[model samples]
Target: MPTTNKKKQKKSSDTAVQGTNDSSVVSKVSAASRGYFRDAFLQHFVCKVARRAPLINRGYYVRWRAVDHCVRRFLHITQKCPKKQILSLGAGFDSLYFRLHADGALDGAVVFELDFPDVARRKAALIGSNITLMGMLDACSPPAAGPVSISSSRYRLLGLDVREESQVEDALGAAGLDWTAPTLILSEVVLTYMETQRSDAVIGWAAKLLPQALFVMYEQIHPHDPFGRVMQEHFLKLNSTLHALRQYPDTSAQRHRFLQKGWEQCACLDMNHFYEGLVPEEERARVERLEPFDEHEEWHLKCSHYFILTASRGSLLEQALLAPTAGPICGPHRGPAALGVRPTSACLEGLGMASARVRPDQVLLTGGSSRGGRGAEARALIRAQEGWRSVGVEPSVDLDVRLHHSATPLPGGGVVIYGGRSSPLSPTPGLFKVTFDPCGSPAAPDSERAEAAKVRVEQMVCSGDPPPPRWRHTASVVSHTGRDFLFVFGGKNQSEPALGDGCFLSLDQQLWMKIPVEGAAPVARHSHSACSYQGGVLVFGGLSGGGRPLGDTAVLRPTDGGFCWGRIDVRPPPVPRYSHCAHVVGGKLVVVGGVWTHSDGVPGVVVIDVSTRSSVEFSLDTTAVPWPLMLHSFCSELLDPEEPELLLMGGGGNCFSFGTHMNPRPVTVDLKPALGAGFPSWS
Candidate 1:
């Protein structure tokens, strides 16, 4: 009786862990039901599960979006090609197959989901019990008696211990998975729970079986960080060990694992940067406004610990999968869209101003001077398919000579520009508004631009106490408590050291509230690249108060009522520099040309993984990047989501010579090849 009781207790413990795994699916369904995001088929799988808490819903929403993005990319790549297969390892109760089928994105694709026997049997029972799920399957072959395995033309569900090599192989064979065909294997937070050897075997098995395939995995990384320690503790409390995390704690290690296991290319990015930069901005905005949220710090901390890693081989998987321009398949715009026009000449002296995309086809550029030491009054209208063109300055608008200001895009289709240096040593405190009228007259030729004006700039006065006058500060638009607020972070105030303070401007109330941070705040700096990442703002390399360049990075997260700052310590940090440009691609902070203390002045590009806090510096090939690439206004376009290209406009001179090459032609840097193979030993 004692032995039996012990066995029963062990079984109960195992069941609890399994339940926790299944609960994730329930959370996703609950989130979808609450309108956090749409997943019509998820409801059928969950079958009236209890709604998750708002925080859980948001986490699931982010997870769903990341996984969905990867799945959609796979589907888009295999759309026109021969029938491909997708294998979901430890799929649990995931409704991906049903969802994809419902959206008609699963055409010519076979899906196979594998999990432990107990979990799979329960899922099989659930499907068998549900007529709707059963009906969705084609004329499928009946499973062998008691074992729950369904095999169909398009979908297959199998129950097996994935750790058993023979069992996994047998299950795949029985499910009719074409090993030789192009395939995409998904392991979402699955392998981390398995022993290191077991997960390695699973990866090795897949690599050996699929000649042309892309393996995508979403799992926890950076287990040594403070947030990661909390994550570890939570899993430990749940009696589930993150077995593989210790072995591959960082993205670099994960990349190395894939490379060692025969994958030709591997790319990994944390959910924070991936969600912010890779996910569609429109989709992010829609889901962000779904629920009232104020846990900005928690959201970023959680996302920073989780990452998506993709490993690929073969040209088909390499070129097609994760390409940004791969548009809607099997629809009106079924094929790839034409690459848009590239900017030739942009302001070289706009060292710290904001550029907002006001329309799908247009971007507004304001507050920058020309290389000839003249403040630019005529705002530039960068149109799609057309190069940069000047918008005639309105005589009614009293524009000030401001540099280092921030321009934040409003939800109602406008931009709020605030805080910049009015003179060489003074900072301005007022805010400026720019609104566009699409119904206005078409833009006339360059000669008639003065008479035919369209865009308008208005200066506004606020009611609340504004922040101190500062320049080179960063501003990001974030949603808080069902309202949009503009968050401004560190910059230098005139005659004062770089200010580490931050504040938020409530657009509706026209109120400015200070964000009192609790943790270690970053040192005051200017000319830093601050971008909206996850639920907060990520500030990268900047110039310190003593006219010294800084290479540290920090993030400002909104806590329960106030805010907190966390500084990320990167190993072998990028050279201390300022007046540089940074862009987020996947999970990396790509730092472009900046003035370093070194003699070269313009060092090569630096790529830092925001997740693991590891960095790799790549010196630009003189043949590829034009020489003397300092102070250039760098912009990145996701021509392909998997591989983004960088464009450098203007700015090419040392500290001794200000704007020698004033109107430098744009230099396009194809980063795809560099990203693949981990930017290996660039000359």
Candidate 2:
């Protein structure tokens, strides 16, 4: 590269990297404003304060929480020492020093923050101008010529490029940093912006200089998955690419990197592990209850791609190491080993749509928001001589707008649709009955059925009590007194954390009916799966009230008098997941793709043999799928009762700030290999 061009590129890169600091402080302010954390200083750094989406707020909260955890741990362990210090790399408008001082946690520790010269000057100016901020600092002198931007007894802000080791060392020495003290070095989403070689050199330099230091870092990882790819692209577009993601891609790799960089003891965990195992449960629930959040898929995916690590050289800091509060996650990441999928031309795609087989050859899909907005018309996927094709149908009556609804196939015929909301604030009321019929005779040719499928949708008005307006619930046909009833359970509304009470609607009368039940009920949840099993329904997996994924399985069986709930234990329990689809065929519960907190990849097929209480998992090979097959907030159904083929359609969510990813077309998953040869055909 030419010298002139190299210099220009470097200048542009530095500007772009520094620009990230502006956005970071704004998000932190948003998070703190929403009670996710307590930070009075961040608001002063931003020009204007604005509210962020719940997902973004939660993301920043975890980042803030992780750093606080490290800081507190380090302070407690080194409290007895006469003098200790904290060195924050790329601190960029962070108020950690002020926050610690206000909390009185900085009794004996001094905090040194380093960033670019421009950023340091900006931060120093903000501090000098604000009366609230000025009160926190001991007498400080204005920044002038050298690397030291702000000088105070407890806080020293420096402007030095971390890539230049000798300059940083000399600057720290001049700032009165104690080299041999029990120092805590913090780097949150930093160091990844530079070239790999530069970042590695920085890490090595810190380890060599501070023998009794604890290095803390929080940054992105797992750069190969769909979410990861989007995250990488988001940064690349900003002209600040993440350099560490490819090499230090996971917790294990990150741990090894620090160890190889001359750190003696190190521990690393993805944010999901930190949030679950390390943070207290009550506090998590409190944060969750602050806002009405429905973006479980994005929250978990965002957490899995970031990590918190602590590395120590001396034994004093070893006690501050991050350790898991619980055991290892159950089941291997199942197989992303690529289960074969047959390509299909089914064009129907949208999240929160409901799918059910109205006939052996016809599947009805209704009521979901699409790129064009909430679909007013219904669609039917009919099997033809060539293949399954989706055809538009005009319903007899408007079902209105529905998202995260349920479509239950009736034993006698027709379908029952219930419980969905157009948006978080508007849950559709009452019941809907949708029936699909072939255009011609009952024995019409497959080609003709594919040409023009007819659908009828009607709102069913009933006399008995109906469940309150809600979405993300499950509805299934369970038999009682030789009559099938639409059993509805587990969902959330705008105000409730989650709805646990189950209600039964008689299919024969279209009236909400009550039947006797026994045993403990499942916890309040939403976005789970329930399928008909032996005249009852088997429910599995959902998001709990505390915003955690659930993996327990239970059966509501038909006793002579009513239904009874009983737990079903499967060895090597499937990893807890939510926002996925499920179906029962030949006594096996086959769970399809969904979002999980497992560190590396999305989940695949988890087939639980309900009869034997055994389970197996398989991964989806979307090699032929058109786009990234995000399978959550989508719908799936068995194309044929006798075959192991399933169709997944209409998923994708707002991927944090990366962008919205919606599966463009329907994809087929062939589960023959996942379910071995001897499986009996579905009758």
Candidate 3:
């Protein structure tokens, strides 16, 4: 239900008989598809959970914290020192202004939230006259900027569509905007809901309206790899609940357009890389506690989707960030693809490798597997590559085989290895961690390499209480209360004989708590995929008991100390599939193909809208899909469109078939538009 009418005028051509026919047909098809996907994602998220849970809370905490980071950066960039006029476009239910004001990060700053009349009304009721809300009012329907008094400050709320150039100008005039002063504008998970042209117009207006302003925004970008395809699909499926889900196929290109329109600077970082930089010091010990999985050590790469960008009236702050100061990144990351190098299918798209990390010059890796007879030889081939080398961590040569998934570099010179699934009957959960650092690089000397390998174990924490253990369970790092927070979503639960509940760990507090969410949470499941977009977690498609499939989607948001849950409304693709991979590139969730069932099946891929919660089915034609089934073994990473070869190692898929035991094999899938060459570029 609720809806907002986009401003679109009928063209004279529409009156032509032939043009009318074509338009009518297109509208019918689009509407039908939108409904299907919206309901489908909602089934997964809301239909299943009735009450808030820890998983949902943690997911919200993760996304909200990310938004908070962007907000602060915007303030610093525009205000020239973190003090200035701030506006939240389409404020929705955003509580950042309130939270930040309460915490003192922005006690004296003038804050304004603009949204639809209804949303603004609800937000006012939820937090009224609470000092933070002193100058806050619903501007969704404001005829003009109306003045309000907050302490000694005077502010006004302007209800106008950013898409309308004249309206924006009027609102700016009414708000007493001074072009000479720096301003910070934030549009979080909002633009993707509008058409590309409209989104572009909004960006264009912002660049031209203010003299020195920074516009920090988050939106969906299309993926260009196999894992990306899978990630895109699940997102569409989960978002099918809302009818107006819009996907931005080219977020980077859009950024360029913003620059062309007048933004002086722009920069973006994928989710994994962003979190790696935000984690605090204490978490470094938690990351170093476990050893790298045998399999994880072999398949080394980082997989993440969401992208954060900061554009301003001045040059973007590209080279000013401090170097890694915390610990090693969790998954394996070879710094951004070397400059000027084009990528292959193995590489992903949408990740601006260069700006995402510190010291992107180094090739990062986690682990891989040895095929029969090809054991040493295969590894030799990998090592021989000009920019490739085996990860330094060793597997536990004893029991419990290790499967390396990915690694993330920490602020401090350390690496956090996340991969490995403990056996079902094993005492602990499937998740594991490892660290390697503080030693010179392998190029330093043999002794240095050995010293690096001899890393000291710090802190190890595991449990079946809050969030049970499960391989491939999605995790994201958030900053809150001056510390890094780790939030985990759905995955298999070896201890509970089912998928575990979601959990979050506070590095500063040294505390781990289960996320309490309402509405609906996914059923006890495993191998499900999750990505955070728009201040919420989008989880779709997974495996349940009896080998049944799950195509529903659930979203978790933070409320008080617990979490709130809401199911997405999306329509399943031609078939209901699970074990697929999901990633958030740009602002959309990309879900790539995976086993349709326990038995043989084909790759199923789709894309979900994070804002409106709708799905768009993309038909991809490929050679015979991978043999055997992959469960809890698939991973995906964001890629820059220009370079196709820099694929982040998605996790590995395991086969339980009773055949010649086979080690994990790395597979690369290409995403091409089925029936067509590729997705249509944004208008």
Candidate 4:
């Protein structure tokens, strides 16, 4: 690339970075409008107010809460100081100064915000036009002059590029910054947009200039996972790549970067840790109730990818800096010596679909929302000498468009699919039992993608007490006496956040009947895994009513009368997860892929030996699978009745505004490496 072209590219990238300020302010205004936080001045910066999804609202709320927590802590710590300061790098349309002034938190403290010249000028113009914003500003220095866009006694907004160290230093000095004052430097999602070398120079410059400082930063990390990949690609498309993530990919590496630059003490925590450890339980509950949210998988993934960090130099600020937390943290993110597994394609893709093995070489899939949108039709993954291929299945009856339902194979044949929804408004009602063609789906030898199969469906009308319409629940075939029953358990409906109630549908009698269910029930949860164990079923992790993942493994075993529940504790405990699939083969429970919190890596395979009371977790090697192998909202089935192999189909979901990511094809995992020997030797 020529130097002239490089300069133009850099200029264009800088403009795009400035444009981010506009979008960010709009999101902040939306979050404030929804009452996630109190920011009266943010609305003035945006031309219009648009409502964001609850997930995005929560994302911004956590970012706001983390930053506010640090700011308040800094203010409280230096309350007695005659002069203090807060310098926000790449500040852009932020309403921090006015909000602080309105709250009367900045008495002797001064705020200095620096961004690209364009963003600063726009922010200054917005402030000058708003009577409310101008009212909060100091009357001594009216808004706008030169590079110093808005100049006031308590607030100074400078329009200058942050990469130029000498320029910013001289500019801050001219704006009345006390070099020796107790300063809190905030950089929220900034710095990462700059080149890694430039960002490093900026970090070094800040540490070298501010002797008594507490640096607070919020930025992206873990750019290699499925969600992280989508996040990186989103920025790439915008031509503003996250350059810092390549070098500083996690909390530890980020903290190390600041320390290596010049800071003394540093501590970093992902948003998950900050939300769980710092935010009070009552406060979290209050914020959660403000909106209706169903995107738990994406929410957790978003939290895991972004982080909040605090690094300090002076002893006074070091004592008050964010501390590194370990034991007090919540969620299931324990990094262990990993067991690696390889990935292969099964040639089927979608999300929230239910899968069941209807034939030796055929797996029935029904009801999921894909990138092409949700359809009432069903698809089948037909296995041959090659790999599994998906085929369109024509059902005798019209199947309603639904996702996150349960498909359980009956002992006789076919599958009973129950309870799913088109959207979060409510769970869809009714149940259907579909039996596939005996000879397998007919398709051309080479054109599996363009062929159709046949299946018979019937609406099963049941009597007695049917379970409330719910999706993301488990419907398993549990045998009692000589009869097989479709045991329904734990899922959430629109009216309820989580459901713990269980119901039994007798497959023989074709009616919902009462069954003696003994022992203490697990907490209300959704997106759990239940597989047939002995004569009953073993239930695993799920998202609880409190919006946390449950890791406890419980078994409901037959004891001559009915069934009894017993909790099992496996050594070397697997991380708690939900939206995964499980199967029992030869007394061992094979668990594969799901969404988890706090951890940096995506979920893989976790195998538990029921007889030995032991468990092991293995990370997937997705080199061969060209796309990101997101494992949530997906379905998996055993390739063989007795083999320890799983054919996982249709995973991924809307990745929290980044975009929708669907596993382009089904993936197969050979559990033999994890269960029998150990991880396979790639070498």
Candidate 5:
């Protein structure tokens, strides 16, 4: 009777241990699922990396590369196949199916995932609870309540204990998995938890089920090594055992296990080799620089103890799995180039200003402050090459220091500088003509070209009374009545409120005439953006008289002699801000950074479709910029019309401090695929 009691006690102890192990496995899966979200939030991955620990983020990255490489290889090899399928064992809460669907890779593929009952149920609940995740799945039919298994058009989630061969077969059958299709089986650090015999049985079962399949496994190895021992001990302390690691001790043993278990061919590689050799160098560099890292020793040790093993039944599958091992199949492409800083002897600064591309490789920059000083009445010629170089800084004008000025490029050549603040308490209402003579005689012997580049600035004597002295206005040169006219609109005079008036200075007649409008005019505002578009001027976002940021948009259509104003209703308008930069590109208004209140508003680029009244915002990688301010003067030029590479230059930093000055270099943003052209490139 005592012996019988001992047997009962032993059985009870074993059952308790089993229950604890099951809980630990689920806990580990939960932790990894959380890690994915954390990594995404932090931007560790191109998709997302929220706020994950650096070590965990980096580790996850390595794991992602291994899995992605195998999947990509499978897809590449089976491109000609009519049907392709992927089965993931112990899938946990992975979002691979959704990610692939987003990438458009799941169009002709079937994805099936199997996990323990609890883990599968929890993952399904999480997905069902979140609208974002649920929307990714093909919701042809309503999901069942409290479902432990779910099926979509291209994805299926099922629950089954991988150790139980019968249950695994039943789940696959119920999920309608195609065993005859070219299949890729993924087992990431899952089989390590099962007994060696159970793992082997699972492997053998897959090999027999799928005649043309590639089984890729990622898990720990070399449990007897010093580093491996530490890893094993860590898992042991977590109440989890590396049961399969002792059986497949290293990559060689792993390969042998696969080949001996009915796999026609097998290949194995440690994570260290996989990372340094198989992963593209460019991709590695990009993620490596995402955050500051100093865990070389730990990284190498951890990677060295893990291995990626691929076993295949068919020659095509074997070749596909081994092809990437030779080298990276897909290397990273070069991002947009910075093209170096804008060459300037001194920094150009101001709140509202102008920059225009007058020549193919040159832009004329005028009327901005230098360092902490007020706007210097000077013009700089910027030449674009491998790097931007200030080819010449013309002599400073004798005119008063000006800020919030307008420099409109003439149709013939040269620029007309209009009303601006001459001093803190004064406004310069007079128009100034600045011309550069490329063929003029030499003044000095520095060089023949340098001597020929002569600049002449002179104040214009108009025929009629000009508009009252005002600053923070917009000016654009438009063709009106068979001649060019400089149109100025909406600004503030000293001690006055914002003005809603508009006027045109006829270059041919040398006469300033008041612009009579027929329709509703834009509200009185300053620091708004205006660009000539389709024989009209499009005005957007500015600061109102009450110092409020305004998001109103209007257009001034050229009439027989004067102008007609019409307001535009934009859906999902951009954030209200002033001193933002805007340019007409591809029938859309591309608005860059701006200032809101006392802070930098949106640092991303906002593209608005004028015809459709729709808008989309693309956030800039903050790491790419020197500062976080929006009131900087910037000039953009579309270099490639087909690819549409827009190069943006000269923007001030977050603050007005001496250190947070304008950036000298140019940053290129590609407007391809997003704009229905191609993918964006940034340098």
Candidate 6:
């Protein structure tokens, strides 16, 4: 646990800096002059963008590459540090975690993202379920921690405004983290937003809080070059789009202040060297020669606009010196913590406030947590709140019903639920359907609602024969010969001793037939993920009864009368994992978060991509033990039509040491829209 010390500091003024000095100005400034300053003011702060949208495209690639270089270096140091506690101070939706999560980089590192309340809220919404964040947006609200899955754990997003010394201390103290541990501190594109002196005080406080903590930062060195002036002007003009930029270091004198605050001056890497590393080797050589602005421009003299700096906590003398006579530090903001907020434990196990989808213009909900028996039940209970409505298909016979995972809606309107556990009382053979009549409006009349509800199951059934009695399997609807078919593969049957495969229930036939899998078949397994593309079902990763996980990849082609299976040599096999969700975005199948243990014996996510056949891993940066989760459930949605990003949600976490993964918490991830060549096409 983190040690607490009682310390207090007096507050100072937070008055805005005056733009005009007492210069004898006989004439009023013109509108153009006023507009110039306005533009610069707006250009001063953080600009918002979609989380996965490449920062490279936004012209922040230079800063981003610098950040990555610094982090990679720090991670090397952290890899040496026994206790890896990563704190992203004023983390402004930085994609560091995204890249880390993509590669499963932080093993044994407990990452804590700290920011002001408003910023934390936005980060939470955008990074929803992608990385586990720590701090709660509304302390009064229920905990946001979802079920722990085998592959991943929740992260904390602590609301700590750097300006508020007390709140900063409070959040740190509450984290129960060991300050003695070697920590990596990141302040990216943030200090410039704050008064220089305040930034210094924060640095001083951080040094005292964790003397061994290493700092990595990127800040705009005061730009006087024409380019620099334009950049500043650009910010000021788009004030609504951009926030205020506090004092930027114009001379080396300003950079000297950080060292005075107890930072051990480390190496500084420039933007050109950084971005040159990102592009292809051939392009990189060319990129290095390219200038951001014209040579004739004044801004061209401002050394690439921004610089990446690394420092360690030590005597300020080892680094740059502070101003001989530094200004006083300002106190915290006077207003309520922008979005007023206020942390949790084992009730027992691991978590969502509501299970239903919320719509715009919906009324605020105030209710208790309802563990609805099935997905439909959960959705129904949550949708009962005013302003939200539910549309879901319950498994014809319940075993374990997952609302979003097992069931998906067709392009037209009908609903499909496959691979649900069959009831012990009455096992289902396979394949069930419920057709929705949106045209038969529910608001029309009681008769219409009855008629819509009364549609017979047989009428919805297709011509193909039903598959076997298998639960804990995967099924997806793919189009073949201009018709949609529910493709099923590899599931455990209560009756059959081993996992089975290759069954297709034609939406048009309604019958279920066991596909005669030919060629090399994937290993017999259950709980594996299956996705439909073109006229094939791609299967990956699952566990056999022997308890060992399988890493086989196979595709089932729907040709002839039945489906045929073949193993396409995935150049590399993913690490054995189960309960991970798979989604086809663009043409890549993203296999996200699955269970794994650290060298220190802690559980977290181990992600792998078969397209490249590489192992990626991420660990919770905080010490909080996530619920041991596996096999609870998972669901995916193509959130944006244009981008093709996938949103993954809901899975169980393990609460007991029963040695089995069973988390009931919901996890989420909004992946980068897949891009590239040789992608599959769906009919």
Off by over 4 Å in 6: 1-405, 422-431, 435-465, 514-516, 558-563, 596-632, 644-646, 657-667, 673-683
- Least lDDT summed over 10 consecutive residues: which range in candidate 4? 329-338
TM-score against native, each model: 0.50, 0.93, 0.41, 0.95, 0.45, 0.37
- Which of candidates 5 and 6 is the stronger one according to lDDT? 5
Best by TM-score, which number? 4
lDDT string for model 3 (289-349, tens) is 2222212111111113345567778443433222333343222111112122112222211
* C-alpha RMSD of each candidate structure in angstroms: 22.7, 3.2, 23.2, 3.2, 20.9, 23.5
**Global CA lDDT computed for model 2:** 0.85
Against the true structure, candidate 4 reaches a TM-score of 0.95
Predicted candidate 6 versus true structure: per-residue lDDT over 395-475, tens digit per residue: 234324322125545556545555443232223443444443323342344333323432112224456545666655676
lDDT (10s digit) by residue, model 5, range 594-618: 5442112133566677777766656
- Model 4 regions more than 4 Å off: 140-145, 321-347, 438-452, 641-643, 678-683
- Model 3 ranges with Cα > 4 A deviation: 1-59, 74-83, 129-158, 224-255, 281-303, 315-683
Backbone clashes for every candidate come to: 2, 1, 138, 0, 17, 75
Residue 26 Cα positional deviation in candidate 5, in Å, after optimal superposition: 60
lDDT, residue 556, candidate 4? 88
Candidate 6 accuracy as TM-score = 0.37
TM-score of 2: 0.93
- lDDT at position 567, candidate 6: 66
The lDDT for every candidate, in the order shown, is: 0.66, 0.85, 0.43, 0.83, 0.65, 0.44
Q: State how far residue 244 of model 6 sits from its true place (Å).
A: 48
Those runs of model 5 whose alpha carbons end farther than 4 Å from true positions after fitting are: 1-353, 374-379, 438-451, 597-601, 625-647, 653-660, 677-683
In model 1, the runs with Cα more than 4 Å from the true position are: 1-16, 146-148, 320-683
